[model samples]
Target: MPAFKQTQRVHDDAFDPSDSASAHLYISFGAHRIRMGVLDAQRNKFVALEDYEVERPSTVENAISFLQTQSVSNPLLQERKWQQVRIGVKNQQFTLIPEALFDLNAREEYLRLNAVVEPEHEMVHHHEHPRLELINVFTLPAALHEWSVPQFKNSPVEFVHQTSALMEGMLHMAERSARPHLFIYVDKNYVTLVVLQGLKLEFCNSFFFTSSEDFIYYVLFVLQEKKMNPDQDAVTVWGELLLDSELHEILRTYIRHVQFGKKPTGVGFSYRFDALFNHRNFDLYSLHFCD
Candidate 1:
């Protein structure tokens, strides 16, 4: 077992969990961290937020244990039975396919042919586009699904790939923008890039990197391959980055319009969350948009 570092914030100290109103629970799990948010559906405000980081032996058991402990300690989680629960898995071995081309019967074979490892224990999941009638086909580990499924058995639960949620979130955010936009989400050991051109998805992929150099290399490579003008195209970044971080500095050196992303405009958050960066925990916040 490993030690887990946890941080949490309560939006309203006067909030009464015994209230009749129901709330939604959103949780996102990564390689080393877990983030959760409790949203009051009627009030349209977040009541509580939490983050847990496992310093060593970052396994599924440790993550689940951390969640279990939080459920016991956090009053907001314990007092109220949530109306809906959604889990976002941040695994990288996923592929996206259009709705028309998706064949439900060949899901496992499709993933297997794409070189997804441990295909036997992975289940296919999909995220439907809001207006295009398109769907994203991806895989989630059975271990995570099995472990989390039982926890939310009493309520309606849906499992989504983090990338799918991010894509949906970005689509909603970028719908009003006319120019081409590149959205980058950085995590512990991987970076996900999503490109949108006039509300249409142009590209979406994830790359693993060991250092800042490798990170920048992939970004630049994608830009060149996509024929996107680094000097003209706009780039919005999110997740695990500070103003002075090495990754931010490197991106600035090559890209002209690099800026941090903002929280989704559709959701309401309490003032207590003002201290945190608007771009952080994008996947967790975006989970609200997941169906």
Candidate 2:
């Protein structure tokens, strides 16, 4: 079996260029845990760092436990830069008592809580919406507007600008990693595509397909759409959907019509942040998908 390599990041705020950034961090307030890594930005691979988990507790003692666990005689505790702790709590219905305690500190902020940590949650929710933990502000993206997201009452899911921007940012981050190949994630039943530029170069892209047949037709249709002849350019797919045989064949059938190459296959399921966060803030957004 191939060994798994780990990376640690401490967020850009924690890094001072004069000092080497030994940590890379991806934080999910809902998860209450920070994915950390000491990354070789050059290789875009993780080195190592301890994963810090902040738990969900309602009492002052539990809060104390969080502080102690995270601050216990650890090397990170010794760093002055790590001292200005800012806490963000997930939205909870903690009776009036705990809620008042949580408001005592200016260093703390509360955000609506959504993700759960049980194994079942990882399997169900995570897969159902692959990009949840990876996007901006810990929410789903806008592209999910077309999905029929389940909801309370008779409402539909909504998309927002910030969420879209964050997803776009994650894609651009992958590109900035300048690593070749694609970073694929699927959760729920939505698919997201992102290609990296190992050379640290930037390129433009257009949404090319939604299905195998769509993949085939779009290639040729887009060429004509852009006033280009079928025998013009080349195409390469970087998606899991390309793994299916039937779709692959469908893609190949129309390859001759366009200068693009290969068979078409399939895709991933994902969630964008804006679509699933802050019910009070974006109440109009129906949790259900588009009609």
Candidate 3:
């Protein structure tokens, strides 16, 4: 297993490790990276953020072992007991069902329509979206469950899919505006598109692409299929995109009102975070809104 390399670490000057009892911990697990942040619930502010990158492991056991070994020396993942803990699993193996028709016993069946679920190796979980009136059925590697349960035994923990956080973040943004909006979240090779008309969720799906052309094609295709005018409907984006990059240029050429999303509202961040792009880590930051 390749080592986990530290990529970014930023913390406020007032951060105190001993004060974790009043803070909330948010962690996101992804294919290539793992990110965690600490939020002071009393102040409604984030005090620390850390990101790590690891070479892709060949198998599931290697991935769990790599994290286990790294957690031994990492203070953040150690003995601290937080006020609350939330974990976000990022992947395409998720599907949404109407809350009215959802069945807890059929979680695997609901997810099987879109993904190949191996119950022996994974645990199926569901998150209810009261605002959207839907239930998100997803899977987390069983190894992850085994590893995290004992690590945070002192604190209460809840698990959610990354899309749930993104949707909640987007819906919160829509509440401030009455107009129809299309939100796009881009990753290295996958893009999640969400459409909202005022506060209603009209569309949500993730697409995999290999090139810039493929990325733009899916974005435009979704707009056309939804009868949204590329020149009129506003499109907000979040993730690893540069203002002068090829993807941004392509987006601007095809869409008139393309803008990057902002960091979550209703929560504050330290001034040290000003150097980071507001759009970058939107999903990780939005985990605060999941519960």
Candidate 4:
């Protein structure tokens, strides 16, 4: 059994749990961590962000059981009157299919092409990107899905893969750009890369890396394979890396215009969130745009 440690938490003084009816809750579940964000819908502002880290669960069953225990003691998770609840699953168990080729009845079959799926233990889910004309088919622990629905009885609980969130956020950022832009999201031991030409997605995938060398290798590989000029194209980064970190330094050494991304626009943020870096939770905040 493992315990979850709170790594970060920030909220405006005006935040109130009783007002959950007017707020949207976003939760992102990763290999060994959970990140949550609360948006005050009425004010169009984000009021809270919390992060928790736990030892990687041995199985999906274990992960769900661990969350079940934590939810009971968490005031925000207990609230059932949220305006909306969005859950972002962060894993490699997903595949994106063009809307025209997607078969509603073959979600499991489509995902199996990229990853092994145990239908008996997991439930398949899909999120459609009308703007992208793509459908993302993924899975979650069957027990987890069953448990989450009741918790949001009065609100809709929508599930999506983290990459879907990234696509939505990146498209929003690339709206006015005429050139292809590269975006990278780094997590504990994985990095998700997305290449966009304005609003159109050109490439997207995730790679696992254990060291700095491996990280740089995958990044440079992608740039070269995509025929992108390292000296000309711009790269925007988000998630766990820092401005002064070794990863950022290595990236700048090779790529000409490497910069950290800002939080998604069109939504306000409380001053309390200023303490966090602007790019910290791009995926969580992007859930607001996931329809």
Candidate 5:
């Protein structure tokens, strides 16, 4: 299958060539898709958004190829003199550790203890959450890491785990509410579940599923294991799901209080995006919160 790219040039006119210095570049890569957003730094609002569906080999080479094409074809990327660049990776084998006991040198062992398979080319990265007193440790393919370095060599680029960005985004959302919330970020065949008990993370894990039954089973299983009542607790879902979709239908059947998650209220988006659903591209948009 050939890769299909969809771009929404909402604020193309907003990109002022003279003010290119006040631009920030954000890119996110997952198993099934690649998404990039360009923001006007001064205005703090997104000016452009691009999404690419992975149909061919979902390899680093294919992803970089798509990115290179975008860099050339997308006027924003080619013309803008971005001041900052941020990349988010949605790879598996990410786990959280208590910040107090985090050891940089022992990341491999920690992952091993958690049953993460060691890859030949791997790099360990951690995101520290001071408020939660937790550190998220994850592995990224060396190929992807090496490929990204030279692409943004002109600027200091920050690499963040997609889950970490999701956590940060969810924490921001949790701040407004006092109740416990279950956040499910759905991808192609996997879902990242994060349980929040009043702004404090209680449980975070990723589960892979092949069928709708498997998906609902894992969600319910996590709820049961966490001692959360489906009837009483709230579940907010985001990403790659439609209201008429089977996944949504199954979830509604079991969970009494399930709703689509909203876009991060902390950031601003162009008015052109008003027609788009707030729940779509939750993780990709959440990359804005990564620091």
Candidate 6:
């Protein structure tokens, strides 16, 4: 491949440019209904290519088959033949996807619910949507829902939380490279802890990444492997947490845009969350979080 060609792809060229995403099928195992759409950028809506239900599948294979073999006539099959598929589950979410069954990683994506909390979460938690720069988040209304999350009756919150984060991660990932990526995080308890770019999130990632250091190391590795800079023209992040002097004094160095859990930046947007990570003692720039 040529170098300039790669650069051209990263920075889209158009009159009105924004990230584009599509779903051959948007099945929420949690919610049986699914939305198949071409992912329109101007509509600011799913434009649902197809609307229906899959009743949720119990295993990864069954779910993929449901999506792949799902009647070719279904309006949801936008690509006709998807080179990949992404599955997002939430709360009591369940079922795995391509990554779970494959030895090769880049071919699929498995986005669990709420995996989008950190960057998208904080960014939206900071700047309102339909307005934020570069990165963004959007609800696929009339698209997908957790009618019945695929999960064991008494699974664990950790698993569920990581799954949610993974889902968010998948949305962000798909929105980024138009492909899947691996996910690992801690929403409450279950921590896949190892996030791999390109391959979509999935059930049972065989790798384990503990500690922020372990996580950052791999990210840096990806940067080097993909040849990106930590600073300019690559991914940037800001984070938040509940205000606690002791915790602040201990981990503040790690947090990006933290404040107390009282006032949040966007009270008018569709999102909901207390900005409990700010402090009266914060410097001027950080004070913006309180508004």
Query: What's the CA RMSD of model 4 in angstroms?
Result: 1.5
Stretches off by above 4 angstroms in model 5 are 7-9, 16-20, 79-81, 115-120, 175-179
Candidate scoring better on TM-score of 3 and 5? 3
In order, the Cα lDDT scores of the candidates are: 0.78, 0.28, 0.87, 0.87, 0.79, 0.28
lDDT of 2 by residue, 1-291 (tens): 121122222233333422223322221122233322233334333222333333332333333344344444534333322211212222221111122234333211222343332332111111011332221222231112111132111222223222222223333333223233332222112223233354221222223244656544544554454443434333344323333455546645654431211111121111221232121111011111111
Task: Tell me how far the alpha carbon of residue 25 in candidate 4 is from the true structure, in angstroms, after superposition.
Answer: 0.8
- Prediction 2 global C-alpha lDDT: 0.28
Between candidates 3 and 6, the one scoring higher on TM-score is: 3
| Candidate 5 lDDT score at position 168 | 84
User: Candidate 6 lDDT, tens digit per residue, 148-204?
Assistant: 122111211111122333333333333345322322232211223223344433232
Candidate 1 lDDT by residue in tens digits, 110-200 = 6666656665667777667755456666777666677666666666778888888888888778855566678999988789999888678
Error of 4 at 174 (Å): 1.3
Clashing pairs in 4: none
Candidate 3 residue lDDT tens string, 187-238:
8788999988878888999898888999999999989988889989889999
Residue 150 displacement in candidate 4 (angstroms): 2.0
State residue 155's C-alpha deviation in candidate 6, in Å.
18
Tell me each candidate's RMSD, in Å, in order: 2.2, 18.0, 1.6, 1.5, 2.2, 18.7
- Over the stretch 1-291, how does candidate 4's per-residue lDDT look in tens digits? 576779899989999988999999999976587888999999999999999887555455556776788679888888888998999998888899999999999988899899999878878999999998999899886787887888788898989999999999888777557777789999878899999887888889988888988999999988988889999998999999988888989999999999899999989999998999998899999988899
Better of 2 and 3 by lDDT: 3
Q: Over the full model, what C-alpha lDDT does candidate 5 score relative to the true structure?
A: 0.79
**What TM-score fits each model?**
0.91, 0.28, 0.95, 0.95, 0.91, 0.25
Candidate 3 residue runs with Cα over 4 Å from true position: 55-63, 176-179
Which 10-residue window of candidate 6 scores lowest in summed lDDT? 1-10
The residue ranges of model 6 lying beyond 4 angstroms of the native Cα positions read 1-212, 236-291
